[model samples]
Target chain A: MSEYTATVTVRLKAGVHDPEAETTRRALERLGFDLSALRAADQFELDLDAESAESARERATEMTERLLANPTIHDHDIEVEPR
Target chain B: MSEYTATVTVRLKAGVHDPEAETTRRALERLGFDLSALRAADQFELDLDAESAESARERATEMTERLLANPTIHDHDIEVEPR
Candidate 1:
């Protein structure tokens, strides 16, 4: 087994309401920062043992489907690298 | 002005307490995934008009300093791309 790090990024799907991003945009505008749009996402990094990068990515994808992301409203991507 | 997108990632500084990450690690472990460590971060994507990518990066850096991250306990990185 090789040490691997999987980075999973989860974001609300397009057209989904994102209150946090909206609030952040408003706050930036109030601070005089001009922005047209904003979006927010959560990134999780997991360190684990796996046989290959593909296997690590598969595990990360499973984790995302099981817990990190809500499939009904979220879209996620995963990247894996050897550690 | 050219349109640009700024991506800012904010993470807790090393040695800083991260309750959410700790909880996630435990949850994943219970699910039978063996992991050595886990960490979580917030990523913000901002679309705005700027004269250059440098300006966009500067604005995003300012946003991170002002609202997106707590300097005392968090560290951040910003990337800007022309849109």
Candidate 2:
């Protein structure tokens, strides 16, 4: 098995309520910061020992779909790299 | 002033406690997947109206330093684009 690292990014689906982003925008505007648009996303990095790159990708995708992400309201992208 | 978009990426300091990233890594390992390295980060997209790119960047940087990030425990990179 080889060492691998995975970076996963997760974000709220468009149309979802993003109170934190909204609040930040409003605060900036109040401070005369000329705010226009705002969005928020999360990223995760993982270290893994996998038999192969392809196998790691498959496992990461499955983990994302089943555990790491809320499929009903979030979207995620995964990138795996050999460590 | 012109409309602009700012994409900000925030990440934990190298030694900070990252329970979420750690938990996710463990989950991946439990599933019989090879695990290597893991990191966690956040992304923020902001829209702004500013007299110029330089001014906007300055304001955004200040905002990031004062509110959007905890400088002691997080580091951030910002990208500004015409909207």
Top candidate when judged by lDDT against the true structure: 1
Global fold similarity of model 1 (TM-score):
0.97
**What local lDDT score does residue A74 receive in model 2, on the 0 to 100 scale?**
97
Clashes of 2: 16
**What tier of docking accuracy does candidate 2 attain?**
medium
- Candidate 2 Cα outliers beyond 4 Å, as residue runs: A1-3, A49-55, A81-83, B51-54
What fraction of native interface contacts does model 2 preserve? 0.94
lDDT of 2 by residue, B2-81 (tens): 88777788999989998988887677678755555667788988777888888778877987886788989998999888
Q: What is the DockQ of candidate 1?
A: 0.90
A1-83 in candidate 2: lDDT tens per residue? 88887777899999999998898878877876666578889887777778898887887888788777999899999888888
Interface RMSD of each: 0.7, 2.0
lDDT of each: 0.92, 0.81
* Model 1's interface RMSD: 0.7
lDDT accuracy of residue A34 in candidate 2: 61
Q: Write the per-residue lDDT of candidate 1 for residues B15-49, one digit (tens) a residue.
A: 99999999998998898878889999999999989
**Real contacts retained, model 1:** 0.89
